[model samples]
Target: MSHYHYSADQLSQKQAYKFLTGAIAPRPIAWISTHNLETRVTNLAPFSFFTILSSRIPLVMLSVNRRPDGTPKDTARNLLAAQETKNETARTAGVIHIVTPELLSAMNQTAASLSFTDSELELLPDELQLLQEKDAPLAVENAKIRFNVRPFQHQLLTDRSDLPMTDIFYLEVTDFYFDETVFDAKREYILTEKLAPVARLAGNDYSHLGLLETLRRPD
Candidate 1:
C-alpha cells in the first residue's frame, strides 16, 4: 500500500473544516429547543457540538458560536433569560431548556427564521406537550430527556485576531427531566435502544443509535 502525506498548512480554513467535520463520522446532536419568556418565541435548533459533561452533578454543555453575521446566536440570547429569575426555583433550575429525539422535527422547524413574534408553540401537533416552567417552554410531552441550564460564563476570544468570530458560552446544568422508558432500575442503566435517539452527521445527515457491542478491557 502507498500513502501520500499532506501537511495541515496545505489546507484552507474552509477545506480543513470540511475535512474534519465530514471525516468525524457520526456525531450526537443536542437538538435544543428554547422558549424566550420575554419575546414569546420558541427556537429549535441542532448542535452536534453538544454533550453531557458530567452526571454526578448532571452537567451539560453546549459549545455555541456566534451567528454567521458575528452576532450572538438565538440560543445564546435565550440564556439571558437566566438573569430574570426572581424566584428561587427558577434561579436554581437555570435558563435554557433541552429536548430530546421525539420532537426532533419540530425542533428543526424552530431553527427557521421567522418573525420574532411568531409563535412556534402553536406549530406543535396536539399530541405534544409544551410545559411552562418559570415561563420557559419545554417539549416535555415528547422529549425523553430535558435539561435546564444556569449561565456560568461567556468567553469571547480572538482566535485569529482578524476573524469576525470566537464566542463561547459555558453553562451549568441545574435541573433535568428524563422519561421512565429510557432508563432501567434493576441494572441501573440508561436503555438507549428504547429511546431511539437521533444523531447528526456532516452535511444534512443524521443517524439513529443502533446495535451494541461489549468488549472486555484487556488488563
Candidate 2:
C-alpha cells in the first residue's frame, strides 16, 4: 500500500483549498436565497460547504468564505444581519432549496460574480419561476425540496488580529416544502431517482446521482 501526504500549514492557501475540495467528494449544494434588508433585493447563491449540523434541533450549517478582498459575501452578510434584527415580526429569513438536474443551468447562472447590491435572481432564465414564502425570501419554484430557515447563530472564523476569513452560520429549519413528484407517501422518504439531485465536485465539476445502493446497519 502507498499513500501521499501534504502538510496543510506548509502549503499555500490555494494549494490547501484545492486539496481539501478535491478530497471531499460529492458535497451537497445549498441553494440559499436571502433578502437584503437594506437593499430590499433578493440574493441567491450556491454553496457546497453546507450540511446538517444537528438533526435533533433541525439545524444546518453553511461555511461561507470571504471574498479575495476579505469582504463578507452577500449571503453571509445578509444572514448575520438577520441574526441581529430586533423586531421579531420583521426579522429577516431565508430559504434553502435543493439543486436538481433540471435546475442546474439556472443555479449556475446565479453563481455569476455580481455586486453585493445586485440581485442574482434576475439573471435566471425567464422560464424559471421565483416564488416567495410567506415571510421568508424568494425560492425557486422548480426545486424539489425547499427549507425555510431562520438564522440561529453566527460565528466568524478569524485570524489573530480578528480579520475574518470565513463565516459559519447555524440556521434552523422552520418549514419544509417537498414536491410531490419526488416524495414517497407510503414509504415516507424521498425518491432519489425522481429527485435527480446534483452535487458539487472539485473545481467546476459536478455529479449526478450515479449508482445507488442500500446499506443496512448492523445490529
Candidate 3:
C-alpha cells in the first residue's frame, strides 16, 4: 500500500474537494424532511452532506448548495423557514427522518431536482406517511429514527461571497423518535444491526453500516 500527501498550500480547491470527498468515501446519509410554507408541500431528500453538529447543545448541521443563478435549494429554503418557526415562538414542527435501505427508492425520487412548483410527494406519496402532529412527512414504515430539529441559527459561509455559494444550517434537535425494535436494553442505544442505515458512497453508490465492533481506547 502507498500513501500520497499534499500540503495545504499545494492543494488547489478542485484537488482538495476531490481528495476530501474521495478519502471520506461512504459517509452516512442524512434523510432530511422539510415543508414549503408557500405550497404547503413536504419534501424529503437524502443528503450525504449531513451530520450531527453537537451533542451538548443537541445540534445538527446540513450543508447546502446554491443554484448557478444564486437561488437556494429546496432543502436550504425549507431550513430557512424552519429557522423562522424557531425565532417566532421558540418551537419547530418539522422533523428529519433518516433513510435506510427500506426507503432507498423513495429517497432517490426525493433527490430529484424538480420545479419549485412541482410536488416531490407526488412521486412517492404512498411510500411516505406523514406524522400529522409534526406536520412533516416521513418514510415511517422504512425509517428507523426520526430527529426533530429546532433551529438555533442559519449561518452562511463567511467565504461564500462567491456566486453559487454554500451555506450551513445549525439546528438544535428537540425530539428523537425511533423504532422499538432497533433499540437494545443491554446496550442502552439503538442497535446498528437492526437499524441497517444506508450511507452514501462515490458516484451513485451507497453502502451499509454492518456488524459493528467496539474497541476501548488506550489511556
Specify the highest-lDDT model's number: 2
TM-score of each prediction: 0.78, 0.95, 0.84
What is the per-residue lDDT of model 1 for residues 85-198, given as tens digits with 9 covering 90 to 100? 534455332333344566667666655666657755666667776666664555445677666666566666554655546545565666666778887867867777887777
TM-score of model 1 relative to the true fold? Answer: 0.78
Note the residue pairs that clash in candidate 1: none
Candidate 2 C-alpha lDDT tens digits along 97-164: 99999899899999998998799998988888989657779888889999888888888899667788
For candidate 2, give the lDDT of residue 139: 89
Q: Estimate every model's Cα lDDT from 0 to 1.
A: 0.63, 0.89, 0.73
The better-scoring model by TM-score among 2 and 3 is 2
Better of 1 and 3 by TM-score: 3
Candidate 2, number of clashes? 0
Model 3 Cα RMSD, 1 decimal: 3.0
On residues 1-219, what C-alpha lDDT tens digit does candidate 3 reach at each position? 897767977887678777777779778777777778888776766778778778989988878867767778887888887666556553454467777778888878778988877766677757556555544444344567888776677776544365657778887787787888898767779877878888877766778777678899999
Please give the lDDT score at residue 160 for candidate 2.
62
After superposition, which runs of candidate 3 have C-alpha atoms over 4 Å from their true positions? 1-18, 85-90, 125-128, 134-141, 158-161, 185-187
Q: RMSD of model 1, in Å? A: 3.4
